[model samples]
Target: MKRIIFFGLLFSFLGLKAQEQATISGELKKWHKVTLDFVGPEVSESDEFNPFFNYRLNVNFTHSESGKSYMVPGYFAADGDAANSSATSGQVWRVHFAPDEVGVWAYEVQFRKGKWVAVSDRDTPGVSGEFMDGAKGQFMIEASDKTGRDFRAKGRLDYVGGQYLQFQETKDYFLKQGPDAPENFLSYVDFDGTFHNDGHKDHLVKKWEAHLVDWKEGDPTWQGGKGKAIIGAMNYLAEKKLNSVSFLTMNIVGDDQNVFPYVDYDTYDRFDVSKLDQWEILFEHADRLGLFLHFKTMEMENQGLLDHGGVGAYTKLYYRELIARYSHHLALNWNMCEENGDWVKNHKTPPQFKYERLSMAGYFHDHDPYQHHIVIHNGNMFEDILGSNSMYTGLSIQTHHEDFHLVHPWVIEWRNKSVEAGKPWAIAVDEPGDAQHSLMPDKDDPSHDVARKNALWGGMMAGAWGLEWYFGYKHDHSDLTCEDYRSRDAFWDQCVIALDFFNSLPFWEMQPADQLIDNGNYVFAKPGEIYVVYFKTGEKSKLDLSAAQGELEGRWFNPRSGDYLKKTIKVKGGSSVELTGPKKDDDQDWTLLLTKK
Candidate 1:
């Protein structure tokens, strides 16, 4: 009888140990999201134990062959299936890691629980929670089978210096063009949140109804097809060949007050697990569609909402959660804040000083294992943040011109300024024009000639990485109410044409050399190898190729029609040559491409 009782106790202990083990899921392939789901302590989004602030989960993954190790932060997933089930309380805790190499990778889970443990110094391991705290395992990863427009096939998009972002595997340079407005994009009706019912501009929540037709049969949806419209919106952007999208992750007191990550509108420390899970679903689909995720963390108004504009507990936790959940994405940028430091000008919120900005960016730089591009949208004091010593990897330029005439020169100015500061920023004209009438609707301005010339081609020719169209509020399908992406369908075609032309060149190596042309046209060239001169108002101009030898061939490209004109010219290098546009409309914009023969 004693022996039988002892054996029963042993069996019970073995069963408990098996229940504590982690269940690894995902494709287990290179550049694929491999998730580690563990059965942790039972907790709720509203639990007094405060899972978000009092508990910390991090996993150290080390590749077997290369010895490359990454300490990835984990989060409290209310339920593993919360996106579909909307479960608020469960024992599930998860960490997602995208393995970059094809080999055996080992991981060790460090689960700690203490006072303010989530925001504590990561170097110190707090009190162990005892549930999967020291769990260790290994998994083998194979080459990704995904291809064509899938980010997994191209690998991570890394900012490897200079003006362009290059893929880790393909070594292809990326030039982004997409939408940058309707900052409340995440305030979808389908998301699990009370922001829609809250009295703060709840009506501004987006239904994205017009994009429902773009959602295919097999695309992801949460809570029984609740996310079709938003998912379909992403589909439409991808279908249009638009490669990036920007939206604010938090906008509590900002223009569109329907978006925030907390469980409640005013709650700052605690997060809504199910809502974030749903966001993850959308972000995962975006990865498959080859879309770059521009995570605009905060707007100007709410920049001072947390910790009174300081990097305190709430701010740290906010950035920590964001990095843990989304930094695994291959193509993304952590925009510190939109129109940051507006307090200096508007004096509404408290000023965010240079140290605070650096502190915030430094937090992301230290915590994020992937080290994705980090940038800040200007409000004022851009010069304060410039220099190689700073953490910012890029800039999101915003200009105040209705016609976007300043887009070209501003790109040049900042690009030169950043280089002069010993750090060259990957500049993009995110918000090109003024708030009143930038990029009017198809009904207001169907041709989009001004926007095409002064904004799109203007910034690109000035060596801007790309541009995101900001829909002005005065027009139909404005920024806040732009339900239909087709409102600016004609402009999208022009954007595609510009991207196709730029992608065909060795654009990464090319630098702006406007002095190469005698006229005041834009010149981007790879020295003697290739030169592209843009004539905003087409006319005959002289190009000085005096630095090169041998003959050169020239061709005229019609920017408006996306066509190569029959007009061609051949001229000897080491001399000034007169270049003329096609015999058609001489006043329209034209691009002259010259290549050494």
Candidate 2:
């Protein structure tokens, strides 16, 4: 049964003639965005390209089958040929709408024209004029048949009152395993923007050389095949079974001035439509490959770079364009800032700056019909709005040590704390620290002791949704500059093993229960049925089995090789059993699994 409740704006569409001048494109599948392109007045390069000023497209789409409706907004798509053409002006204005119901979705377009048109309501008379008003059309959306890496097959990842993110289609919980470094992940050479590492904030330049060979046939690109390198990089990650990557869409005042979507870094008002379209192609490919786009919207240095600490002109347009263009993605979150709290120059962003963040995140929550997860990366303090009443639904944390045991407590704190405050917060240890040398490449740290025992297993056993390994700054592909993911293949293998371990078990129903161990070890359990324990530094212990009524069995798991090292050891109920480490790798780290027989 489908549950329907009002969120955002809902309205009925007024039908118009069967044939309109506008063109509709994209897959007609439920949750898949349908693009509506219309002809508008052509402006010259000299004319300021301001959708916020010159024009507005307010489209209301209604599901014919269920009578459900969504008032989706559209934007200015340069020439409708942005991927192949960089024309300053052409009659191509488009609106992208993701239908929630699989049926004939009818839509009506109310295109208004005026100066500063984007600043007010649809009916507000701000230098009023009518452009493509009263335009109407309908499209059929069928059920999707995408699977494997395709998020469409898996469904939308939503924050549904749990410590984990549950897939809307499968209703299964998602466990993330991916990269969190190469902060300038979007500064690809094929992208439209200027780049200067300056050898200060970053020393390594980016060309995405290693994955060039990975670009196979059928992949997309912009003008003259300019997007292969970046798209291929995503392909490589997906092939490696990694499902996520974090990149800054804008980094003007930070490390690298190479990836902003603006026509020019200094000009935030006007976007580089061609470049953004190219990005959209890559994003679509990533979605099909089952990779989550972790869009880190802002870096620490410039949290207040937009509108001088207030949410206004530039900030509004930036977020509006981002939502209008990419909110349709099936799996993603609009992270307000990377390492968020007041990283502005001189004095910090004033106390009033809190309202700006509220406004920015609130805009996405209220405007985006999809309502994707909203989170903020760590800054100097715990997020101020981690509650049920706040707009934030999750947290992207960063730490400062090689030992990730901190991962466990922090995750427990946020998850339990937020739920107590009324909403369960999905916790992801995106960056585990000592940033100078965090999760080094496989070559730099062969054992990966701290990361595996502390960060990966610790966080998961503590009910964390998942973890993303951040490359330390000391390595060749540190946080600021990473082009080749293969350098961390060994570590990636460990992550795969960890995720595989959790997926094979009913980990979702379990919670951290460390009190059952006599020795210093980690445990996650469902009390009377299933339990998992991790032994660090070859520690031994007696697992208390009093809660379990039936005879209990145990198996020793090797974190490094993803294999079972020992057969089941049965212990009588209401008794304690001594658990040992791996038979041969006795002094090394290991994990144990227990379940009632």
Candidate 3:
């Protein structure tokens, strides 16, 4: 509270005027990391930028020595059609600032109107350089003054009568390792066929050991019968701090209990429907690794048809038996099912199916004496199918065909709807593009490109738990087979690369926002006091960030060379920013982290 008051007092003392000073307004906290957008209603049909109401702006600010300007990272528009009564929208003017220096500063925005100009303040050439006088180092410009009074290039002056505030600059922010620490930008990897007990050639364990770790098998028996494999995988994961083992199912698929009657199981007797005492070892082993088991009560596509031999009743008895058995263990989530949609759709009309599924879900929700969180995996991405259902606790949409950049918009949509419906939301993607199915051309595969993009952007915008890559016998897509257990882990090569990409980001519990600067490429930006942009499609695109106001510091990194490219840039107000870099390569990706300096 003291800190907030101190900053507020400092700002108040910077300057004062009649409430009608030039105004610029934006949210203090950005959805993503880059640009702050102030959305206002559009009021006219005038095309400022020729056909569209576009106004170009050049933002100039005091840098270390002279002045500096750089292109903002996203899209901006003032829509005149957005007005219901007095509300109007369109690109009134664009502003961009790359402050190389910090402290109290004043800057001016030059706006060039196209076809129509309403007020003289917006119709002019250069506007007053309002003093946004007190900020730290290297952050995005977001603060604004209340008064909306400024000048135009042709000497036309307009008074906005204390409506909005002008944007300010950015500062340097650091992180700590505690709960309130800076943030845990993450690095995640999907160790599917690579490190499992089935043991394929583990490339990551040998080559990129510095950047890779073992992922816990979904269940103890999921590791296969090779006891050494379990120890080896655990040792490796613990060494790398890959400590969280989600979906730690104790029941061995195809072994313990039969999910489908078609397959026979040697360990079918191991289920011991009468007692759960046998499962303690699995939970104990996970606890020994400093790991939390994201225990899923059931896997997907396994629940038998309700009418088939009364399996539904048997399944309910099993859940009751299990929950009564293992509900006391420390788990991450009471995972309802790997694919929750099958349950809802199949069980929709039947009282037994619907009621049992709903009842089980409610048991986890209401009667879990352990107070654990309930998270269910849904098939479809739209909230109506999964989120709107009474059984769902949070939302997890597997990214099958979508690119990583779409995570932000999806999260925004989910959050807004959840708020309206009065529910707390969680956004997670356990699967992205299928690992086996390369969904792209050799160099032009949008799917492959989106796969990597999804890993990064998912964490950035959706606040995802991280993405999962499915790996098993290509033929055993549905169930595990003994033949599927190979000593060779073929996909570790890509997994190592993906993990490196994840670790390279800053992903500690970042929130989502509706604020955006759409550059029209795969690149969509969410700016806070800092800016984070995702360039998908593996293509270079141009962005008009003239409306962006702040000091900027960023670099382009060659993911292949592991080298950072330093370039000096100054964005003109409302002008398009041209991006240059490699277009396509498996490892050819770049990240730009800009803060107002």
Candidate 4:
């Protein structure tokens, strides 16, 4: 009888161990997403137990060599293959980790259950779950085999105390240029959700049929090939050399009213698992294709929808899920809101005060192990949030001008103001033009001269990191309705030209030195190293090199054609030098690049 009892206890211990096993997947490489899927308690989206809010899955990943560690939050994944299976209930709890170093990574899982345990700050607020609560494992990561434009080769993009974000591994600064329109890019019909038939602006659901031709043979798709067009859209952007794409993740009650991560339009706490898994496929493809994700969490119209403009349980859960699921990506930012904090005077929505913004940012700061750069789009509170102590690391500028003239000065204004406030921001002109006709199609304004001179070069020369074109509502493929990115193909080429020129220089170390030029042009310089002078009117300008001590090689670049004039000049330092564009097209916009010789 004693021997039989001992064998029974040993069998029970083995069963418990099997239940606690975690399956690790993905490429075991540095900077690659290594996913850990655990078999935990089974729960449906509408379960009374509240899988999203009541359960917390936190995994501690530590690099064995450096002793570096990260406590990454995990979520209920629903059957472990929900993207394809579309299962509503399962025991698969998961965490995604992008390992930064090439070595052994040890991970320990801590699964807890209680009321609002997901957002709770107490160290031991809840009791441990049955399965995978203390599961532990280790994996070896090799050097990333990816190269070229794939972000896995570059590592995480970190805001390293400057006006630009740098890749952790490559130490390369990023300059983004992509489409900012059709903000409801995620409101697709292919995902497992009722939003398509919810009847809340259902007509805005995008098929992305126009980009289907861009999809390659090996690209990922879900629910038996339902995500081709959207995946193809990402391919198109990467092919065009545009490195960023912006979309509203949740736009309930906002413009278009078609995007949200919930199981239903109004379900705040419960998330649609399969739908988000499909989004992960697209976002993962974006990372592989070198596209930066601009996750505009909320827009002005629906900023008050969650917790009525406070960082309460609903808001906390919303952000927690977002960070848990998508924050592992290498190149992305948590844009707090689009046109944030506008309810101060309008009173149409509840006010999101400075404290609330800080609180939200504080949550991301504490929860996100990567500590990704956080930003807020302008509405009315940029001035109020400017300071070193402020949590925002950047600004998304929107200029409501018919012409692109304001793009330059607005970027300069905020860049200077942020610096004066003791916190320099990575400013980008996201919406350079007005709501009606910002960037017209090639059929209308094929030349795109004003946009090139005033917006593209204008913003960049003012030390703005980059610009994303917003298609005005009056034009074809407007912001809310753009399905085809080809509407602005020609303009994208212009953006590529600007990016290529800037990439060839040490732009991260340069600052806006407009005072060094006598003409009404723009100047960006690193003093004695290099100088980039933009002539908006293609006129010659006298650049002051009086503070330098060497000769500089000068080359005139035609911004329109993306070419060097071949005719180069040598200028002496310690004096002002007159610089001219190429004589062939001297009347058009040109950029003068001067490097120390």
Candidates sorted by TM-score, descending order? 1, 4, 2, 3
Count the clashes in each prediction.
0, 2, 90, 1
The predictions' CA RMSDs to the true structure, in order, are: 3.0, 5.8, 26.1, 3.1
lDDT, candidate 2, 219-274, per-residue tens = 88778777777777898888889888888898888877676877765677777777
What TM-score does each of the candidates earn?
Answer: 0.96, 0.92, 0.47, 0.95
Question: Which ten-residue region of model 4 has the weakest summed lDDT?
Answer: 346-355
Off by over 4 Å in 2: 1-21, 44-46, 121-129, 194-205, 342-355
Which portions of model 3 show Cα errors greater than 4 Å? Answer: 1-226, 238-279, 288-292, 304-317, 320-331, 343-358, 380-392, 399-416, 434-450, 454-461, 472-526, 537-548, 558-563, 566-576, 582-587
Q: By TM-score, how accurate is candidate 1?
A: 0.96
